[model samples]
Target: MALSGEDAGETIDIVEPAVRMGSYLAEVQPVEDAAGLIFLLWAIQQPTIARPNAFVRQSSMELRLDACGHQITIVQTPSSMSNPGVTGAVMWDSGIVLTKFLESAVDSGRLVLQGSKVVELGSGCGLVGCAAALLGARVVLTDLPDRLKLLKKNVEVNVKERNARGSAEVCELNWGDDLDAELTEPPPDFVVGSDVVYSEAAVVDLLSTLRQLSASCTTIFLAGELRNDAVLEYFLEAAMEDFLIGHVDQSQWHPDYRSQRVAILVLVKK
Candidate 1:
């Protein structure tokens, strides 16, 4: 099947086969000169290929923070891919982008991290949270229960060993669940997330947790990959009821770290 759309003399076509034996391919093509359009071509499956043993091994990912003059090492377990339900074991592009954005914002004086209380939701691999802590923000890195082991290890290796200016503690924070006093005793000055808005079913629960974590003076920054338009739309629509949402333009992003497939949004409690 083929789907197409047009805007301002630019057109895009998404073509995919209606049926396939072991795998499928989806190709997105731009018919006109859409300068900023991003084309994605991906395979849905590769049943014939053997599973690699590397997928079950743990790998170290190093992210250098020029601003902090240090490198944070994150351990990524690709084995999580075997379990379709697991997403936090790997480092995603959105997480890297958000971490760099935070660095840039703090360096530019657009954001202040010194002694600020920050909370990170769905902090996969704890990259963003560790970055925040190194920038002098006392940060809480939270995720589902099963994700805490790896998250804690990352934080310990990067933040604790380096004796960063601030601190980070890993915690279990299932969305829509009762809020822990440690998370809300004083209400976080900022709540941040990356690649957390990927499903329509989780939107409501995510919003509920956001609402509970935020105070009237709180600010939220969320960075996400633009993979599912419907899921993002649903989240934004529901969030508007209690937040004043604003998109962070690409021009405002870090110069060396940006992508057309990723978006950053700022939200203030309304």
Candidate 2:
């Protein structure tokens, strides 16, 4: 992608486990060091799932990056290596966890796409929020403490001044945690989520948090990747009580990965 004011390979690579990895050199605009930018090269190469099974035990390769302008020289993991999660960076630093469903929801224009005052929940690497901000939406990239740190840096690093003058913000947001106090300011006009619901317990907290944020007449849009039939069932059961579910289906972003179809649900005043 061409980052404005930056040429190709402007990214700064953070270290991953693999050696003999690829590298690149490019020009990058200065950015705030404390900004929550996820390190350029951290992917949850471990099955891309939470649980680790026999396959999980196998070694996994990690990606290395060198940013130049907005272009990055990324080295895909070789087939031989495994286990890139040694740094705990993968969980929150991975890119495009569920781009297919996310893009679908955003492109649909079904919700109140004010393109202003938006907050994202469980914004792992903040890709979705970044995309929203790119669409002229002022967005907040939020997750846990550690994750927020990197995410904030990413916003400063990746976003150009031309994009709403870098209107994106990053903060700590934990589901099942405070939804009110967590919002640094007044209620946002819109709230978005992606791949936040998969577990039984997470679904409860996710819905509870979504419900809490649902008030204020703020329209909310969520795109999730259900791992299995059970998780899908739980999503329906929990969401049915609070949200008006809409469009659901399976889709893919790239030919390599296909995120399961999702049901779009909008929070209505109860």
Candidate 3:
């Protein structure tokens, strides 16, 4: 629940509201495998759902994450009951981890962000995409059309007017649907997503989109909270058939913020 960076001045603490408890149940104790991990996360979440809260139509918050000497500021919409299913409006811990990972990878020269064409799927609140743009990648942040309003606003505030080599743009992208024409012709060099794998149905859709967009040269990164073992297992099983997938080492990320409840995966065409 704490995102600490390299410097003493760089640490940023985020306090999750009672209404947003569903998204903040991370950092649990490690379990044996994916199944046990998922069950433990599920068990932790059951009681929090029984609470109640007032409706918040709209509000904004600023979040700062420091990693690899880079301080990234994100403008986001905090969780609200008015728009129940619009998960993209809020900032989740998995997104924070992935954003920091991108910065760390770029700083370590393990990944290239400068002048790369990058695409972010399920870019809720656009934090990860904004981080990518700040690292000099031309980033396209995509989500369902209904989610684009808030997603676009976040991108506009955080990523606009930057002198970074790459700029951020918002686009409509429904997983499992036909690939958008603009996205296919150039094929992004890198694809990324955070906290996107949650349901069995969405796993199928997400894999289909990845297949359509990826080639032998493309690299994909996905970060997800280990909140559902069955859903996570389904995605890994299906993705392994077409793309080589492996868990990213926790040592590669900032030590202060890494959590066993979250995972980052690297994927490439087989």
Candidate 4:
């Protein structure tokens, strides 16, 4: 059940909704009604829901930037393996918008990407790389091998404009398997991930994987959905051993649910 309000004590019970994969690339969405939301919750309670795309999509993340005046057409693939459509995985606040914001920040000189070889962990549709490539930064789109099938296809599909404009690489990166050789490049100046710390062990693995994939003093930028601050806090506590937790952006959905506001934290390697 989606907690509509802790104050009001309202939870949208979205456990099971009709799931259909239409066109190759459509969009992701949330449950529209309480019953639908409850159905989704029920469905997710089961163990089989490893991959959750907007099986019954009802919302989306807009990619146009009015302030920066950046325009990019992003077409996403079916919600299956790669598009892990949970709040952190594929929700509007977490996935598309967060990735877009991170990319825009990097492009705007906020994150300092003059000559950084960047890697996006769990790059579902490769939208982050699309924007990063536009700014002349070499980005590696990384995800699981099975997911990479559609990932490569999505990159080929959505990034025509990006590729025509410049260059980026699409590759397979399993967390602890073969970080250095698979990407076939220098250690990433930084590693970025969004909504990746779902389970407790996953959070630990994420840190260990980054330690192996980057330099001792490597920089890392992560945008979490903040399903619970505990996840961010857990990561921060463990991450402090190798790097400093720099800045964090925590966001909340407005009362009307029309827009999302963010509060982010940035962590710098010490």
Provide the overall lDDT of each model, using Cα atoms, as 2-decimal numbers: 0.73, 0.46, 0.68, 0.49
Candidate 3 per-residue C-alpha lDDT over 1-270 given as tens digits, one digit per residue, 9 for 90 to 100: 322222345532222221211111112222123433233334433423432211112255766666334455656566543675767776777787788777776766677788988899999778889888888888899998878887777777666854555689999998999998677779888899988888887888888999998876678888877666778877777777877655555777656557666777777767
- Model 4: per-residue lDDT, tens digit, 1-270? 123322246554433332211110111232233333223323333313323321223244323322112455444333332455322222334455455555555544455554566677777656566555555556788876665664575456545543434456788766656466645356666576755666666777677677776664355655544344455456666776765443321222112211122223344444
Tell me the tens digit of each residue's lDDT in model 2 across 99-130: 33333444454323335577888875555566
Point to the candidate with the largest lDDT: 1
The number of clashing residue pairs in each candidate reads 0, 25, 0, 31
Q: Residue 146 CA error for candidate 4 (Å)?
A: 2.2
**Global local distance difference test of model 4:** 0.49
For residues 141-174, what per-residue lDDT tens digits would candidate 1 score against the true structure?
9999899998999999899999799999988999
Q: Over all chains combined, what TM-score does candidate 1 have?
A: 0.78
Better of 3 and 4 by lDDT: 3
Candidate 2, run of 10 with poorest lDDT: 18-27
Compared with the true structure, the alpha-carbon lDDT of candidate 1 equals 0.73
Full candidate order by lDDT, most accurate first: 1, 3, 4, 2
Candidate 3 backbone collisions, by pair? none
Candidate number that wins on TM-score, 2 or 3? 3
Candidates, ranked, TM-score = 1, 3, 4, 2
Error of 2 at 91 (Å): 8.8
Higher-lDDT candidate of 2 and 3: 3
